[model samples]
Target: MPRSIATLLFLSVLAGATPVLAQPGGTPMQLPRTISVPGSGSVTGTPDKAQVRLTVQKTNPSMEKARAEAVVVVQRFLALTKKLGIPEAKVRTTSAMVNPEYRWDQPTSRQVLVGYSVQREFEVEVNDLDKLGALVEGAVDAGVNHVAPPVLDSTKRRELNRQALAAAARDAEANARAIADTLGVKLGSLRELTAGGAEPPRPPMPMAMMKATMAEAADAGGAATYTPGSLTFDATVNASFDIVSP
Candidate 1:
């Protein structure tokens, strides 16, 4: 058909049928009755555990000399933990790396091998939060040259998650009911539900005890103060429900 004839026929057909209701702005819209709601809940508690990373590095002219010194230092670190009453099961070597040190030789305009560096890292889960500050100080004094800021944790994670989830569910149900009342409808069977959230917020929110622990930390004259701060764990849930006649 010609463009003009096709346009005329389309208008004629629309005129023959009853126009379904349009949303504001004359945009045609249709849908089955359903409501979706988003809800979130949180529970707060004190952190009772700490996760810490400790590192020892050694550089020497010979690769064997550097590696041997690194191993001895790591053993002393493990021994310190045992002396502190921290169980051996809680500590493990996380990474070991040996890299060749390079120097720019301006005369030759090429990189030259200067030495070998051996680095070892360990991950420790300390169950006793009270001893966290002391542990960091002791570990640093013992041979740890690098320490990532300790990550505070709790033993009651499962309990907190359950509480947060329950609160989220109740929150979702309340929202559904409120919408149903507004629309003069009864909230019917749940069509779908989903719950999700991070275990702990990434780059965990700063707690009171967090401190800068660079190589200079070991040289500090006094032990650093540690404060285990309280944190709230949150959970989010999305729910969909059928809207039935009241």
Candidate 2:
């Protein structure tokens, strides 16, 4: 081939290679600046009702005797709650168990059957806070040995949750505005929003000593005093908004 022809061919190949080298880089593109923020809100309200776990336990030399005694104690407890004006629907049996007691003989390496113990538990719901202490005391007098502290709750929890969620939204909006100001950008309309479900209300710790004193007062026929503690509803929200340059 002639030298000029060969030179022209080489130049054509070089031109084609230049466009391939100019192709875009494989790295990811840069995105706009954005911020994520979380906000929390809470609302407090008085509990309307409360529930307690009460148990009657009895042990005797004979299984039959233990079962009978347990039944009597449970009956007395139910009667006492009824006398206190607690509705039957509000009081119900939760558990009943009869188990045999075992005694281990070290010398013989054998298990000896002693007797049976019977246990019965009831759940009680109280609408009046003032009567809470009295109710526990009354049951204790009626033979309840194991009594769990009362769990307080608001019957209108749905309403309380709604209020808390509204408050959380407002809080989230305020937080977004503050962030936008700090960034020297104008706050734009909300682009995305997410809400966490409300948490269940927590009950106050039951004072065992206080409960014993209340029981003693009830046994003496003296009025027992009780103050219902308030509960708080908490909610959280996550919101995103478009960021506009100033």
| Candidate with the greatest TM-score versus the true structure | 2
Task: List per-prediction Cα lDDT, in the order shown.
Answer: 0.76, 0.77
Each candidate structure's count of clashing pairs: 0, 0
Show where candidate 1 strays beyond 4 Å: 1-32, 202-223
Residue-by-residue lDDT tens digits, candidate 2, 160-228 = 888888899999889988877765666777778899965667675467655766867768879666666
Please provide TM-scores, in order, for all candidate models, with all chains considered together. Answer: 0.76, 0.82
Candidate 2 segments whose C-alpha is farther than 4 A from its true place: 1-34, 212-221
lDDT over C-alpha atoms for residue 122 of model 2:
86
Q: Per-residue alpha-carbon lDDT of model 1 for 1-246, expressed as tens digits?
A: 568755654443333322234679999654335668998898887888788888999999899999999988888888878877899889988899999999999999999999999999999998986667677777766777887877777788889988998899889999999977765567788889999965854233243335553234446765555656676789999998876643
